[model samples]
Target: MLKKQVSSAIIIVLCLFLFPTIISANTNEQLELYSEAAILIDAQSGQVLYEKNSQEKLPPASITKIATAIYAIENGNLDDIVTVSENARNAEGTKVYLEAGEQVPLLKLVQGLLINSGNDAGVAIAEHLSGSVDEFVVDFNRYLEEVIGVENTHFTNPHGLYDPDHVTTAEDMAKITQYAMKNETFREIFSTKELPWDGETWDTTLINHHVMVRDGSYEGVTGGKNGFVTEAGFTLVTTANQENISLIAVTMKTMYDNQVYEDTTKLFNYGFQHYETDTIDMNSQFVDSEDNQYKTVENIYYTKKIGEIVEEDVTTSGKLVIKGEDGRKLVEKKLELVTNKEKEKQQIKNETIYQTDDNREQHLRIIIPISLIISFLIAAFFFKQTRKI
Candidate 1:
């Protein structure tokens, strides 16, 4: 009895040490962030790993240029030369100093707009793309809503100058960054630390304003952007990749620049250290109460803490939901019920019965002739017996 008790204790200890979900659930706690709004998401799956007031509408400041840059890249001809308009030169706040009538490629304007946070470059790009900034606003907001799937974001200008109505959420900003990062041109420009700049009145190297990427402050830093306005405070977005996993972190309305960076770093660390992608194979099957089998048509990946228990629930309508231990949904996949081809084949076989009218008629004829022969033989025997008597 003593030996058996010791063995059971050892087994319990081993189980406690082996499972990651059990360890994570007991040890992990949500990190506190300094920013008013922040979110961390898996770049591949778009799953929110952590958030604090992520959907709160706040002025995005100059980070609004992220949308402007990507829009220009997708819509405007980068090689086309743009003649700087008077409106562009007179634009206020951080600028590369474009002189009136200065001829520059749209690509250079984009680089200046993103790298230097130049309000002038944004206007110029806007004018070149859509004839005027007013016209550009219409298309910009349309793209944000229709193409990018950001419902809460609104933009009034090409540069993130403070506007009362211009606002975005941390979650929405993260989504925009995730979408923008897919473009090679945007990624190259966004990740660039410094580039040679030759302007009509000014000549210098344009350096990226975001410290995490430009200064190599963080490991695996891929790209980043920063924005600041008196009304908006400090806002920052950064993307990092490690061990084949990519993440996006966005912090908005922090009191200080350091706070934004600190908050962003904390968000990234929490995601990388505690969470991982769990994949559900499409070929896996589950049976319903009625014995109908269902399967996913494509593989699904979701982010969750290591060693956390994930539950699967399938509704009769074929919605497959993956939930965390606390019953919060992590991923929802649409599944298709398996088709029972064998049952159909069996039904078809049963319907194709071999009995025909001719076969039934032949059987009836054989039975009648045999019956007549037997009767006749019986009658003959009876008659012979009577004669003997």
Candidate 2:
């Protein structure tokens, strides 16, 4: 009775420990805001921390210039002099007042588009890169597909002037910005508080536009682009870092500027408050021996140390299972004796190989049937004994 009671107590304790981990792994909230779409992401892990209608397509306004700048920096010579064309000077909306035939370097034009939100700079950069604005849009769309991994985003022009068909989602914008941020030149240009061009320095007067950058909660408030139009309302993308925790917060079509900033601030705060970088040792014997069948599986060997930084509330716990191609569990691992410290150490030792289980394959040779002889002998002996009785 004592043994049974002790087993029941252990079972109850295991259930108590596992229930919260399961719940934390799936816990999330979908906030409703005036913005058409929004998303907060961990910059390092590319993990979506929070989202609100993030996939809804909407006008991206000047935010489109980010992709344009990336293309220019990658393809064009920054020192090359690009002569302003008739179309570039006549480009509608915010302009840097460049006259036709006026010569400017590729670098200045990119800075103009990013800093002053100049629509004319977008046209100039497009014309210089692809010989025409139309061609640039095609290239931009292709990059959006191939490099940015954005499905719903389309660019009609270098400047995000309102086109009925030109649209992108908050999630896509986050993804694009994340990609663009990888470029050293793009990051330098986007984050610049003051830029000098045409013998005049353009200071960013719109400091209050992105609250996270101005508020100083983050150590390196790198730089991000902001946008707004009658159709798009208000949009902003901001990147901030606190210690090793870097985050990107995007808001679109917010009813008020304060609302967007407030929402984004909340997201940044939530990430820092709940989430942390945890170093798990993946080489520990606990994780290696987690599945007793690891030794029995052919062609499968322990690989590398793997660690994941997750929310404090979310427990990093999973059961080891030998699964077939169809995802049916063939064997379950029983962790008879394992310590949390050993598990954590194993996670850090080799993280890459165990991060994904997709390549784990079952070998046919391991499934040979040889138990029939023993079963037959046991049955014959049992029958003879019964006859004697």
Candidate 3:
């Protein structure tokens, strides 16, 4: 009977240890539904929470404008006036009706492009920045490679209208949108529900293509781009925040617009509902220590919370390894918490100096005398010349 009881207790403990990991693994595996590609990401930390075929290449419709807008904002001055060229004014599909030779502020062009899905505005910005649409597209691709680090994305134009060669992965788009959101101006423009420009109001009304913005289901639904071409099917990117947690959801190749919204909503809901960020205390060390050896070091806090960890029961402890002059470990200290809150507090000790051993002191003494002798010789030479004169 005693042996059976012990065996039962051991089995229960083992099950408890393994159950959460199994559940989390299953949750990640079960995220796929009615889309060629999708990803849910934590906006603050840029951690991928869930993904399905996220790296598969697909046309990115108007979503390509995210990168276009980022490049323009970083490289081009917003106040600089961009002249509308015949090429930009007549570029096909969803135009702001810009006329050739009409000058508009670059800022307004950005607003128009993002708010109204204006293809003309995209071309205008591209041409104004790089002198030609084709040249600008080349620079745009380079920006993706260099600045954004998007390996799987290529752009043929500033506007994301379907061309066979222009494509990006769902994962790449999430990364691009995540980076774009870091810019305050980009976030402002993206989250703007409505804006008036050029005596016409570009409003995201009930009839707007993005159903997520139209229906107020998600409370802090900031802003996102929607796209569809015959080739790409329905694709949507959505950003939302709740109680300081922000999430970005991407879905591609859905059968219908509603399905795109539904899939993205599911992504956001899952992230907000199930996932949360818990701050873990990493090793805190002293900075600017005057005496590295003494305990009387004034505390100068150097603390970093480890990035997002999903499991609840996983507790972390830190070990400090102090190195000698030869880069060998001299002492190892493991931090023990007096209180639970102390783990959260990043208290560091500073103004400490290591006590010099006889070898170190001898080396310093020898170097100082040599330096003094060299200085005296230099001074004597100068003084002797002065006396002779």
Task: Give the top-scoring candidate (TM-score).
Answer: 1
Give each model's whole-structure lDDT.
0.89, 0.71, 0.74
Candidate structures ordered by TM-score, highest first: 1, 3, 2
Candidate 3 residues lying further than 4 Å off, grouped into runs, are 1-26, 199-209, 278-389
Give the TM-score of each candidate.
0.80, 0.65, 0.68
Model 3 quality (TM-score): 0.68
Tens digits of lDDT, candidate 3, 1-389? 99999999999999999996776554445764788899988776566778999999999888777788888899899999988888887889887777888888998888778777789999999999999989998899898889889889989999899999999999999999988999999988887766655623233332334666656666789888888788998888889987646788999998787788778877877777665543224433322222121121222221111222221111234333443223433234344433443323333212122334656788999999999999999999999999999
Candidate 2 stretches greater than 4 Å from native: 1-32, 199-220, 278-389
Higher-scoring candidate on lDDT, 1 or 3? 1
Off by over 4 Å in 1: 1-22, 25-28, 279-299, 307-316, 325-327, 335-389
Cand. 1 TM to true fold: 0.80
Pairs that clash in candidate 1: 20-307, 21-307, 21-308
Deviation from native of the Cα of residue 270 in model 2, angstroms: 1.5
The candidates, ranked best first by lDDT, are 1, 3, 2
The clash count of every prediction, one per candidate, is 3, 20, 11
